[model samples]
Target: MSLNFHTMHDKNPDIVASLARLHEHHFGARPTVITGLQGDGSDRQIFRLSSDANEPVIGIYGPNRRENEAFISFSRALHQHAIPVPIIYTYDADAHIYLESDLGDVTLLEWSNQHDDSSSVLTMYRQVISWLPKVQLTSKDSIDYTKCHPFAAFRREAMQFDLDYFQSSFLSRFLRIRLDNAALANDFNLLIAHLLRAPFDAFMYRDFQSKNIMICNEQPFFIDYQSGRKGALQYDVASLLFDANVNLSHSFREAMLEFYIRETMRYIPIQEKKFLTFYYDFALLRMLQALAAFSFLVFQKGKSYFMKSIPNALQNIAFLLTQDDCMLRRLPELRRLFEEDVLNNPQALS
Candidate 1:
């Protein structure tokens, strides 16, 4: 019985054998229950494997070897810097199976849903914001850039990838909006240039939204940072405040942005005016990136539930397109597609 793997015998026997051995090696006994846990947007399988004697640990079965390497490497480095990330206990590289301390499942998104007080929620977000600079400035040098998945830094090509992703996934493929190709490409270049103007010396948590945050013991612990790389600080800040899930009001967003600037200035030299100028530019980029992701999930993966977020994302895009400093003004053809075609006709997106 000690060697017998529980629950996972049917899902993937090959992985179960390796995971069972790893579990037994660490806990000295077979897990009593290997309960399946939820996953994010990745193709990773997770479980809670535990027995009566030992505290439960999160079991992971990752299909992507490079992503696994990035997560494990960053986890170790972040842990060393006293960051509040989950600790990696053990892993079987060949099997793509690993174990880490479980932090429970209360995400900042869930926590926000449960708590409604403006002041309290603001304080909570402030706390989350306060840690971003520390995560960026402190543990950044310790992070092995080579371990970053796909790319080691947020470069022009990466930004273009997300833009092209949105265009392919939602605009051209789904909506079939006839945008001015030359103008669209011009606008993309302008946006990319504006984003890269900021200091790019910090760890950019590529998806720093609420759902990626875990509320453990009333403290914030970050996860899903395997996609992170060296990039401008404004992008992550924009990601958090402008998160589609919470959809913090503009006033609150402004207050939180101010708080972030203050927190960031404590550790690094932040030109407030310069940071604000580039903030919304990155915000637009983040929203479009998210829209691209949601669209891909719905259309390609057939996750129909993601379709619900499209309208809100489109609304955010519509707002950004109207701003004077937004790149949309510089790209009228793309702006017309959003204004007259996609955003104006919601049915086009569906």
Candidate 2:
């Protein structure tokens, strides 16, 4: 499971020379500064490259060629639809290097933290909600699904992958919970069926959380959407609304989910009752997916910073489980296991 990308020091000759060439070609002058940016949990390398005369630009060295290609292609498609994604300036596929427009350092999470007032945060969220439909619905028919990484759409197999990962990585390895594979598979089937009931002919931003949202020029610009594909609209909504670390209030989630519904109505017709039912189910499924991912990055990828979210993810799961009438309440064995670990151990999801 080695990610196929090489990491280099800032002064590494090959990296500097390659980025210098891209900067020289795109900016008409060699970059005078090549400052490395703070890295993320992933293996990708990022830098801010610029000259005194030109605006700063981002330089990326991705580990997986296919993932890079998926992102580059998706960026081009979304930009054509006037989405505020970074414009790809130039790239060298062989070198795994690409340059993009610099969207300064502010993320929506950071922005929200700066504005402590709930009203201000709500306003910013409304602004972001305004764009969610455009990203999910408007560009659905225009983009090529073939270029989507891993899967062209969120299907049964994709849903199963999350459950399987949760069992193997999170439940067994982290929580050390012995699971009944046959019984859990039945619950998995019900979960997948519940999720697929929603209309899914829209673009799904696979990682639409606050961290991927860049607040530039007083507006939100989306990034890290190389994982986009056709899927249920509720999935991305669930991702943002129940994001593990954010801890949005119950009232805020209610208001925002309503705001989202209104905005989404402008694009497509949806039944309120059915959508809400599916939304909560998707939220549960999303929490499981988050736990799976956080554990994967921490254990398999060796990105220990990912552990920061495990507690909140477990909290979200606990809150979701409190609904006595939800889909998860039907799966007794699996539900018991989650409750045992989460309730017994306050931190680290036990």
TM agreement with the true structure for every prediction: 0.94, 0.94
lDDT, model 1, position 22: 91
What TM-score would candidate 1 get against the native?
A: 0.94
Model 2 TM-score, 2 decimals: 0.94
lDDT of 1 by residue, 1-350 (tens): 64434455336766666676798898787777677766767788788887777898888899998999998998898888888999998988988999999999899999999897888898899889999999898989989999998989988989999999988887876677766778788888887887777778998889999889999999999999989999989899889877877767878888988899999889988888877777778888888889888878877877777787777777778778777866666666667777778877756445
How accurate locally, in lDDT, is each candidate?
Answer: 0.83, 0.84
Ten residues in a row with the worst lDDT in model 1?
A: 2-11
Residue-level lDDT of model 2, residues 1-350, one tens digit each, is 11112334543567767887887887788787777777766678788876777898999988788788988988888888999999999988998989999999999999998998888899999999889999998888888899888888888988898888888888888777767888888898988888887788999998999999999988999999888888998889889999986989878998999999999999999888878888878888888888888988988988888898898887777777887546887887678877775557655753
Q: For residue 68, what is the lDDT in candidate 2?
A: 88
lDDT for model 2:
0.84
